[model samples]
Target: MADYRLHTIFYILTSLLSLAVLHWTVHKVLLSISRSKFKKANNCQPIPKYPNKDPIFGYDYWHALNKAAESRTLLSWLREQYRLYGNTYYARLQTANVISTCDPENLKAMHSTKFKDFAIDSRRKFAFLPLLGAHSVLLANGAAWEHKRAMLKPSFSRSQYTNLPLFERHVGHLIEAVRVENTKKGQVDLAEFFLCLTVDITSELMYGTSIELLTNGNKDLVRDMTQSAEGGHARWLLVFLANIIGNSTFSKSVSKVRNFMKRFVDEAISYRQHSESRSISAKPTARNFEGQQGTEPLDVKGRVIYLQQLSLGTRDRKAILDELTTILFAGRDTTAALLTNLFFVLAHRSDIYDKLRAEISVLDGERPTFEQLKGFNYLQSCLNEALRLYPVIPINTRMAVVDTTLPVGGGPKGQSPIFVSAGTNIAFHVTALHRRKDLWGEDAEDFLPERWEKIQGQGAWMYQPFGGGPRNCPGQHLSLAEAAYTVLRIVQEFSMITGRDSEPWTELIALTCTNANGAKVTLTEA
Candidate 1:
């Protein structure tokens, strides 16, 4: 209803604006008729000419009233810009509401040094806070964000990750599930399987319990919640409408899911606290095999897992769930999207796929074994290129807290900083930047994993799928490593068929990148 109201209001406004345009246009045309003999051929470029304006809409996403659409996609437009303007040009679709940049220095400053110069938009915060609840690090910033990050950092630390038996078991079950699906249907939904694998892994690692997502694949609860997140984000108009409606039944349902997760987290925290305070000082704990290279969970059965008593320190139940959700969501969705795309790319280009398979074969004994993934330069490069071509998050937005100036160059001499006023929403069109013609050359749109082979020492700003600086995704390195390992294993276990020549379309759901239909493919045993 609220969405309908907003649409009605927008339609009315657009109608009025159109009428006004018609009125002015009639007068202008009359004036032009009178001045045709006097006016020069190219005196003015166009009326309402916005100097230094950005492409408001090329990848037209009318699907979203106020937000960008997923289908038209931002990356495609970025390439179009290079075709016309060398590297930069002003594009206007709507009024002056959004400012976009593929400028490297602009990105570095915004994503890194001057990050706090902007804030997450209040509208977005209101929507997510209800969905994620409070104290979640994802919604937290400043000191709060720091504390939460520090607390969760240890879990992914080198020592804690020594639980390789756990890793092996999770991967084994994942492969097993795929095997079963393959037997049944001659194909498998890789995205769903990846989510299950990540969810199950997060359950064991974080809570020391099996959500049993992998074993039974019956737990549709998490799946449902994820769909909510995805579906909710798909329509910005609805989200805005919900916010406008405030306490409607739909709003309450959103709150109900948030509360449900809250309850689960609360119970876990309480149980953990009770266990810790018990101090059973039980039988002598097993030896500490943590420092050993490539140590799996089987090596430390009775080890004193001091932190087993998961007491919430200073932080509350809500924070834990937030971190838990953030990691789980981040781990599962991004990896699946990247891997799915990798398969599509490889299926088209056999040479690249074969080269990567050989690379993975050599890593038969070296897949993220403690630290091998970080050192797997070829695999790392391939993953980087994939991310560059198609970032999991095509675009990330920031709201300027104050009036700011963005540097512009290679234009008319004496052109200075482009001024953006406070409250102006700035979108870092990452997908556009990724395949930018000036920075990446002509083959920017093409998938060339070799593009990242020598990017480390060069102007790294051109390659920013994970973004750059402090707010740069902390999970990036981990995500990349996990992706390389998983894709390597998938290729090793199964050869993929990209459904003949029928291309899969991508749609942005919420902020996540998902297959418009499904990443459908036929797989045969490797």
Candidate 2:
């Protein structure tokens, strides 16, 4: 009886093992057939494969990438890769397939033409989830993303951003801080001031009150935010290991930022509830200003409040908080980085500074109205050039949600469509794209604002400093206006600004990129 039972058990185990093997084999065969058909139907051609020393895992390529990042030469190294390989090339990273491209046609296809075929991917969403929350528009996808985008769109309308008076008070605080710093240190770190200025302005817009970092010198919130952003960046860089290794500092910093933001969130919610109870309408009123029509809801003090406008969309506290945090993060970093990078270059190039000053001279010591700022062609060119050279978000990525084909990045000359498998990661290098000689001419690597004057437009996919397509940054207009206003104010105050540090601009790349050496400059009071 015992021998019979043993035989039966052995037979059952063997049968189960055989079935498992058969299932795996069938699945693989089907997948192979499907991919072949897809590739054939699309006329897909093979793309250049990166020469990886460790072909299986591409450890050699990964090591080189991390090394470049550590040495702050990641941007230059990536640009060099495009020169060696074609505009698009493939590599393997462990179990994942990676495609790196600086091709405009590929970018346009991924970002716009076939947008629904791609997603933000789990890895990137996971990296940002801790700080931005799961509901944040930056991390959301599909229906969730559309809903969040809708909720936030009203808050960023033209009227809300064009309220120049909203930023003036914060700008005053920044000017005072710069004046004091210049008096004491004989040179100013404009990068630091720009960060403070943006933070203050963003806070004011979000809560209808400023953090006053420029005046109060309270940096705890800023410090926590920076640490959290750096932690997110690190996690994104080391995505494979992010889930395994716990980062206690990252946790603590995210907690601090959330707690700080929650206070404002709670206040906004309470205010909204109270206003509703009193039957006060939150709808924006149209107002005509300088022959232009715009609309914005004003607080009791007659100040535009983003939080209030956001509250009207949804009473959900968590939703409001997530959107606010994401906006604050974007609003604070992008403009500051743009201003810092532009100033860093201007400090080095006196001729560019003089030309910019000449353009702004039309304002004649008068605070620039929104219309007036828009009219300054040379000033806009400088901003455009700075963004091209040092885009705030230098690199971006998207993941294939379905098997698709990029319009280019295949064949010998890379003019053929390439099949992309679902789950493949595509990293588009904006810094490299901006410096493509074929697109921007021989002086592509040089900082020349005059180039903009000669060209009609940057040709859709060729220049995307603020990105493109549906997910393109909504805050870009606001950022440009703030940057232009701030630059005008600084130039008006100082007759001459010269670089204090002789070193060239090195990247301090985090969630955004800026000058590592800081915008260190000496100013002559006008």
Candidate 3:
């Protein structure tokens, strides 16, 4: 009886102790967050307060204009902030958190040159952590990033993987997928079609498997990524917590995702291992990465040319899988969204469609070879126009790595030269920059493909649909080439007609920009 009584008392004491520890942890976390907010606010110059800002769009710094996409369309209430406070304005987003920054020069300084100090929102452990996993090349920070960049360089090189055969095959796959889906449809969702095409092409070339996502029409990876992004526990609330908690969650998720990638990589690695086991001791490398080796790196069509200094054969299984995941998420949705917008735009103007078709017909009465694809100047311009009008990744974020100054439109010292403190949050708001009236010209709001011809006069950094600077998308050519090819094939097969009178809006939840109603279009056989 005495022993039982003692044990019960001990149990009660242990429970109380645990509770105390938790309470202290939470209290300390709240204190740190509060302190950070206060420090940031004190350091910042005050701006007029706007009530009920949309949190979904960079922590409520902006207001939704009725049907404006939370992230993608129109002047974000950010313009209003810029208007009020000259460019560098401070807003108390959370109880103690202040988010600020909007200047082109500041954007350049934070993103490039000094990017090492400002880290990616490592808080993504909960929401976007599983996205690429630890093995994802794009997600890596240190040596891992360097390694992956080296390994994957050959795959997208101009002399190697960017050849006629691969391009045509993938393009064929895209066109064929569209034809199957749009057979005599009263109205086809071109967005869905393009999504499937990108996934199919990306999976086959990158993973050596079809994933059959098109035929089956559902994949866990795509669905999971979108779901986590839209609503995830870890990313949802980090303001009132310690940086350690957020960092741990993010790192843990990356680790978990890397674990997930292991399965796919293991399969590929095992295959490679077995294949090598059967091969002759000495060989001149496999043709799998054909036409890329020992060839002089040539600048093709004025794009940046660099030596293929990294051989991708040395990657571990986890690394390959992560890169594949990143590419799948990045490549598939982006290309799909681009094409969706293009078809949506092309459907209305038969004049534009007529011009595009006339150009396609001149592709020597055959599918465009990669060289011919490059030569289709009008098509490229039209696609570039689409990208400019609606970038796939509407916004990009970074941290202030150092105390810097941003030269915004107009503020103190003639321009809004923002004094950035290290650790301050930066919302690049590419959507705003792309639509900035001052930069894009008088008819910037209009969807005119001829904007490219005149864009030569505009600044290069100003027109960053595919982004600019050193960290710009390595796969820009791949994306443009794929999109151009799909668009070319789409125009070759059918014409899209406006199928609805209902107004269209872009849906921006998390990172991706997708059409709200599936990019509906009436398809007619060519």
Candidate 4:
């Protein structure tokens, strides 16, 4: 009787399993048919697809991951896809159906004009939450984004321009560090030095404290941050999987970095509290911050440190930490990349360096004042050319919240606009867009600051190294000013900057474009 019951149970289980398999197969077939009919009814041409090695098992994604791993970048693969598929192409990754484009009209629509139709894709935000914080301005959308922007925008005002002296101090430290290297070995890994300089400057200016990373640098922390950024680029599905699997090494490292950042913020907050208490006790009438110039309005100088502004509004430490990390995220590498690239190109070209040095010579060996930095048109042009050639964030992404049509780059002929369904993600390669022969001329690849000489009348949309529209980077002016000041300082100290290697700058992606082998330069003392 027991044997007979066991046989019957086995048969029942097999029958149910077969039925489940049949149901799934039929559903897939019906869904495929429905999609085809829907496309036909719309009378729209499908977006071009880049052929992949495997279509069924997400082998294309795997292939991309492997290639990215081998090349230490995903940019080469993206450029290849663009070459094969023209202006726009469609590919299915593990996370979403990606529509990649280099069409300027399409870019304008996605980023500026129809920005409301798309978002940063909340699904992808999860990957960065552990690192950038949940309410980070970099990831927040809608009212949340606006609030974060409001909190930090005032801190960048003209009165805060008094921080130029602070920027100069760090630049001075950077020059000293490099000068020592020039005396001893005649070469410095400027990539590393630039990272340290930016870290110190960002900490001091924003938190009213300095980490001294440039003076006493942290190699391990820098390596970990770079690794975190690279991991930040991983597909969302993989991140989800890692989260579900639980206790991942990546998760641990992320936590470690978060803790490290939190500690930095806590210390800054502690210092601010102590400083304020001392100021109140010492001077009952007024508690003055040293950098606050008497002529500068309180609206600007009073809120120079972002943390102080936030503390006035809320006692939420997590929010403060989030904003602090956000500032560090924005301020550190982006400026460093700009400065490093500027020096990299300047090191290779003597004429440009000579002109820049002459520009600085007029300052009479003193630090260029805030207004003085703005007048260096050649310096401004060099910075612009470097940004155009190697945009720190080369690619930007958005996802449609509803079915939408791009203004251009579609159809079998590749000239018509494409209809992207809801949830479809779109990306624009700023690197490719900046280098468009049609937009920037045939010599777009050349690093010529003079190209910008007659182009003062151009629109802001044409060159968006700092991004665009309402969601555009708020720190653009500050970055330009800081970089221009640093270049002037460097020029004042070094007459000639020479590349350690004659071979061209080997570009690499580390959440930003940087020298792959490192930007090594020898300083010729002024």
Top candidate, metric TM-score: 2
Better of 2 and 4 by lDDT: 2
lDDT of 2 by residue, 1-526 (tens): 9999999999999999999999999999999999999999998999999888788877888888888988899999998888998899998865568999998888888888899998897767878888998768888888767756655566567875787887787788888889998989899989888888998888876677788899888778778888898899888777868768888889999999888888878877887787778866455433211122323447675555677766665667887788779888888878999999999999999998888788888878889889998898888889999999998888888999998999988889898999999899999899999999999999998999988877776657988888778988888788888888888888888889989999888987878888889799999898
* Candidate 4 residue-wise lDDT, 1-526, digit = tens: 9999999999999999999999999998997787667656655576788675565555576567557746655665666667788878877665467788877778778778988888887555866777778767888887677666766766677655556878878888888888897889968878788888877877776776777877776776677676666566553336466566654555666677677777766664675576557642121211122212111112233545666655443446777777788787688888889988887887788899999988778888987777788888889899989898888888778889876678666677777667788898787788777887778898988998988887874336667787777888877877888888888888888888888877666566645676676678888888
Model 4 RMSD vs true structure: 6.4
Candidate 3 structure quality by residue, lDDT tens digits, 1-526: 9999999999999999999999999998997786567545534333333454543334443224323433344335555555565544555444322344445565665556556755555444334545565655555564556545544554565643355555466566655665665665556677776777777666655555555555666655455544544433334344334344545434454455446546656665664565456642222322212233322122233221211111124335544565656766676778778887777777667778888888888764477677888788789889888877777776565555555444443234434334455666555666666676777778877888877765673356666667555456767787788788777776787744554426554545444565656667666776
| Pairs that clash in candidate 1 | 165-296, 165-297, 286-302
Task: State the TM-score for model 4.
Answer: 0.82
Angstrom error of the Cα, residue 193, model 1: value is 1.0
lDDT: which candidate is best? 2
Go through the candidates in order and give each one's C-alpha lDDT. Answer: 0.58, 0.84, 0.58, 0.73
* RMSD (Å) of each candidate, 1 decimal: 11.8, 4.4, 9.0, 6.4
Winner of 2 and 3 under lDDT: 2
Clashing pairs in 2: none
